[model samples]
Target: MARKKRPEGTRRPNGASSIYYSEKDGKWHGWVTVGVRDDGKPDRRHVKRKREAEVIDAVRGLEQQRDSGKVRKPGRAWTVEKWLRHWVENIAAPSVRETTMVGYRSSVYKHLIPGIGAHRLDKLQPEHLETLYARLQKPREQGGKALKAATVHLAHRTANVAFNEAVRRRRMVENPARVAKAPRVEQEDIIPFTREEARGLIDKAAEIRNGARYVVALSVGLRRGEALGLKWSDYAVKWRHGCPKGSTCRSRDASKCDLREGRGTLTIRRAIQQRTWQHGCDPDGSCGHRLGAYCPHRRDGGVVESEVKSRAGRRVIGLPHPVIESLETHRSHQEIDRERAANLWADEGWIFTNRLGRPVHPTEDHRAWKALLRLADVRDARLHDARHTAATFLLELKVPLPAVMELMGWSNAAIAKRYMHTNEEFVTAIAAEIGGHLWAEEDDTDDDDGPATVRLAI
Candidate 1:
C-alpha cells in the first residue's frame, strides 16, 4: 500500500481517526486496526507526499515498516510449551498457590500448547491470536460449547503474562498477545445490592441456621474457600481462642489465642480442600464443625483443617460487630444441633457446619444461594458481585482507599478502582468550580442560526 500525505491543515474523515501521523504534521502516516467495517477492513495504511515529500523521509520510512509488518525485531524460537513450563516453574509456582499452578499448567498444556505450540515466538502476531480465539468461540458439534468470556479473558491474560516474561528474559522483543484485540466482555447489569438490600439480605440470612456462607461473603467479601474452610477455633466469642479459621487466618496468632481490646477478628489459616484418597478414608475428610470440647479425633483434640479448592483461597479476614453477632447466634444454633446428634455427628470442627457438623461445600452454597434469592424476591447475581457491593459501599462511606485496599486484600488500587465507578456529580461540581469563567453567564445575542453565539472552548 502507498503512503498518503496530508496538507498542513487538513481534517480527515471521522473514521480516519485511526490513521495517525508517523510524526505530527509529517508527510506520511500509518494505521492498523482490528475488526471489519463497511468502510474498510483492518489493515495498515501509509501516506506519502509524492507531490512534495519531506527531505529526511524518516516518517515515510517508519510508515513503510508498519505497512510491511516489519516493525518488530526477531527473537528466540522457543515453543509455547517450553516457555509455559518455564513460566509455571520459575515465575508462577512459588508465588501462587499449588492449585493455581495446576490450573495454569492445565490451561497452557491442554488449550494453548496444543493449539499454538509450533509458532515461533518472534513470528507470532495479533492476527494469529485473533484466529485462534475465533475457533475457541465456536461450539462443538459433539458436546462442549465455547468458553465463557471470563474464561477466555483469563486465557488471554495468561498468554500476555507469559509473553511479558519472555520479553524480560530477552527471549522476545514484544508481546503479540499484548496488542491483540480480546473479545469484548459482554456487560451484564449484575449490580450489587444497595445498603438496604444488603441489610434485608443479612436479615434473611439470620433466619437460615447454615447460611454463614452468605454472612461471611457479605461481611468480609471472602472467596468461597475462605468462607467454607472456616472452623470453630477461627471464632473467638467468649475468650481469646485457637487460631483464626479460614484460609487467610493470621499465623502470627496461631500459636496463642490473644484477644486485644478492639472488636474480635476471625483469622483465616487453613482451608478445607476435597482431595482424592486411596489408602484409607480420612475420618475428618469433610473438615466438619468441631465442638471445642470434641472427643477422640487427634491427640490435642482440637479442630482440624485440610486442603482447599485452590491455593489463592487461603486468606484471613477480620469481622465487624454485625458479623460477630450473626456468627454467635449461628453457633448457638449449631451447638443445639450437635447436642441432639451427639456422637452420631462428625467430629469435624467447621464453624459453619451442617446437621452432621461437616463443612459446607461450594455446590451446597450455590444451591442455598439460588433458593434464598428466590425466597427474598431478589434478582440473581454471582457471589463475587457481593464483593463489588462491599467495595462500592465503602467508597460511598468516604473510607480511605488504603483502608479499602487492606480490607479487600487487593494487590493494587487499579483493580479496586474498576469495581467502583467515580461519582459523576462530584466530578462535575469540581470541574465547574475550577473553570467557572469558561461557563460564565452572558447576554444572549442570536445569530442567523437558531441558537445564540456562545464562546466555546476549542
Candidate 2:
C-alpha cells in the first residue's frame, strides 16, 4: 500500500523543523537534530505522543534546553541496570582494592540493581529512590528484608555514585539520588574492655598458641588484618646484651641476650584478605572458565595481599616490654612446632599460623578469639574492640590526643575522639580536680547554737 503523505502545502504552526505529524501512524511526532556524528550522520531523537499538543510541548522543552546549552544528545537508552553494570565493570573496578571491589559488586548486584534497576537512567526520580528505601525497611515477610541501616546506606551510596558518573557522561541532566533520603545510620557505642578485663583476656590468650597475636592487638591497637599479616622479619628487636650503654656493638651472637629485656618495633605494611578474583579468566582466552563454584581453579575464591586500609594505617608501632617478651616466647613455640612437623611444615614465615605453619584464616582467628574470651570469663567483645580498649586506656591515662592519634594510625582526629570514651573513673578524677578548686573546708565551728553557717566564697 502506498504511504499516506501529509496534504500538500501543509506547514507546521511555528515553522520549526522539529514539529510534524505522522499520517501513516496516526500519531504526532517531533524530531530534533542534536548534533552530527563524525561519519556525517545526524544524531537525532524522535519523540512521539498520541496528542499533537503534547508533542509540541515536548519539542519546545528540547528547544529551550538546546538554547540553554544543557541539551544532552540522545544515545542508546540506558537503564539503571545497564549503567550500573558498566560503571562497576569499567569505572569502579580499576580504582578500588580487590576487597572493596567485592563490596561494590555485591551492593550493585544484590541490592541496588534489584531495587531500582528497572528505571531509565534519565527518567529516575528522587521518589523512585525514596520508595526503594521505604521498601527496604520492611520485613521480609512483607516483601522486604529489613536490612540494617548501614547496608541500606551502602546501597544508597552505590546508586548515588553510579548516577553521578552517568551525569558526567551526559547521560542524565542531574543525579536524582543526591536528593534521595536514606535511613540514618546510628553509631554504635564503643565497648572497650576495662584494664583488668584486658589483662585477664591477655593472660588467657597466653595459654593459647597464638597469644602474641592478641597482645599485638591489645597493646598496639593494630587492626585484625594488620596483626594477622605480620611477618617475623617485620619485627626489629633491640637487645640489651648487644651493646654497652651508648656504644654500638658489632657482636653477632644469637644466644647472648636476656629475653626479658628485649624491646621491639613492628612495622605494618600489608593486610591479608581472601576475596573473589575480579579478573576471573585470562583476557587472552587461555582459560575459558568464569570465576564461580564450578571453576576448577580458585573455586574458593582468591587470596589477596592488599595495602593497609589507609595511608595512615601503615605504621611502625613500638612494642612494650611485656608484648615483646610474649612474642619471643611465641617464636620459640613456633620453632618447636616446626621441628615436630619437619617436612610437613609449610613455613609461610607468618608470625601467627596454623599447626602446619600455614597462615591462620581470618575465620579461624575469630574462633580462637571467642574461645579465649570464654576461657577468660570476660564479657564477649569483637576483636576490633581490643583496638578500642587500647585507645581508651591511652586516653584515660592522659596521653595527648595527638599522640594517641599517631599511635593508633588514625588519619582523622574525629575517629580517635569517637573511639576513645571516658569511663566513670576518669570522669570521677576530673570531677575531683574541679571540686578541689571550687570547694574549701568550712572553718571549724564550736558553736552548736544552730547549724554552723557554711561560708560561701564568691
Candidate 3:
C-alpha cells in the first residue's frame, strides 16, 4: 500500500517549520534550512524522513536561544607569522635553552617567514608546505649546493611543530604540515677515528703552524666556543686547604692548620662569550699604557652586547687526563711569558689568549681547526665531530649508557641514544651465535643415534 504524504503548513512544538520527506536521484534526503538569500528574500529547504528527527531537535534548540547568535562561523584565521610570534612569546621563550631559542628564531626568520608568512592560516594547505619542502631540497645560492636530507628534515620538523601548537591553541582547526610528506632522511653513519688515526692526527698537529689549536680540539671535545672561551681560572688545578695555626708543611695532622695547593679537578663552570683587552694607564706621560682596539663587542668603534649564544650552552665537562696535562703544560709556558713582561704585561687570565691576553672569537677557532685539519691531511668534518668521537669511544669501551649520558651532560636517554650506534663486529658475532644452533644438522653417518650438542656463546 502507498503511504500518503503530509500537506504543508504543519507546525512542531518548536513552532518554526514542519517536517517532510522527498525523493531525488532514487534516494531520500532530509534538510531544514531558514535564512535569507542574496536577493534579500527568504529561502526554505525540505527535510527528509531519515534526518527529520535530528532536524527537529536542532530546530527546537535554535528556537530556545534568546541571546546573541553567531554572526559568522567559528574558524581559524591567523597567519603563520602571527602564530609563530605568539608561540615564541608564549611557549618557546621560557622553556628551552637560550641557544635553542636562537636556533628556533633563526629558522623561523630565515627559512619559514619568507616561505609561508603571508598565507592565511586557513589558506595554508598541505600543497604550500610541500612546495616549501621541495625548494629547500634544491641548490642554495652561495655554493650552488643543496642541503642534506637531514637539514631539510630539521627545518620541516621545526615548522611542523610550530603549526601543531597553533592547532592546539584553536588558532587553526587543522595542521597542514601534518599532511605534508617529506623524503625519507636517514642519519649518517658516523666514521669514528681509529686509535691509529687519532694518534696520527695528533702527531700531524704538532707539525702545523698553529699546532696547539688542534691539540685543544683533539684533547677535549670543546665545541669551538668552549675552547675559544678558555680562561686560566677555568682549569682549577690547584686546591688550597684550610690549615690550623700550628700545622707544619710536611704534617698531615688532624689538629694542625694546613692549607696548600695540590692537584684538583677542572670544572667547565662558565664560558666567556666576549672578550676585550684593557691596558692599565700610568698617570705619568713617561709610562703610557694603551689598550688594544680589537674587541668582540666593537662595531666600527661602537660597543654592542647580546652576542652570547645561550645559557644551556654554558655547561660543565670534566677534563680528561690528556686535557689536564695539556693545560698544565700551556700554563707553565704562560707563567714564563708573564714573568718576562713584568709591569708591561696584561693581567687577563685567559689560557688560550693572544699576546694581548684577549680571548679568541668563535670564528677564529673554526679557522684554526680548518687549518689544522688541512695540515694533518684529514678529510672534511664538522667541528661537532669531536663530541661524537668522545661519545663513540666511551661506548666502545662498554661504558654504561647512564654514565655516558651524565658525562655528556644529557639528562635524557633519548638525546644520548642518538649517539648510540651498535658496534658492527659485536652485532655480527652476537647474531651468528643466536642463529648457529637453528641451522645445525645431525650427522647421518653415525653408528648410533646420539643427542646433538648445542653450544651457546656468551
TM-score of 3: 0.58
Candidate lDDT scores, in order, read 0.64, 0.80, 0.59
- Estimate TM-scores for all models: 0.58, 0.76, 0.58
lDDT of 2: 0.80
Model 1: lowest-lDDT 10 consecutive positions: 273-282
Q: After superposition, how far is residue 336 of candidate 2 from its true place, in Å?
A: 1.0
Best by TM-score: 2
**Local error of candidate 1 at residue 257 (angstroms):** 24
Candidate 2's C-alpha runs over 4 A off are: 1-74, 140-146, 241-260, 276-303, 400-402, 440-458
Badly placed stretches (over 4 Å) of model 1 are: 1-77, 85-94, 139-149, 237-262, 270-320, 344-348, 421-458
Cα deviation at 256, candidate 1, in Å, is 26
Q: Across residues 44-82, which tens digit of lDDT does each residue of candidate 3 receive?
A: 344343555565665554333212232111334667888
Tell me the number of clashing residue pairs for each predicted model. Answer: 29, 0, 7
Q: Judged by lDDT, which candidate is best?
A: 2
Q: What is the lDDT of residue 186 in candidate 2?
A: 92
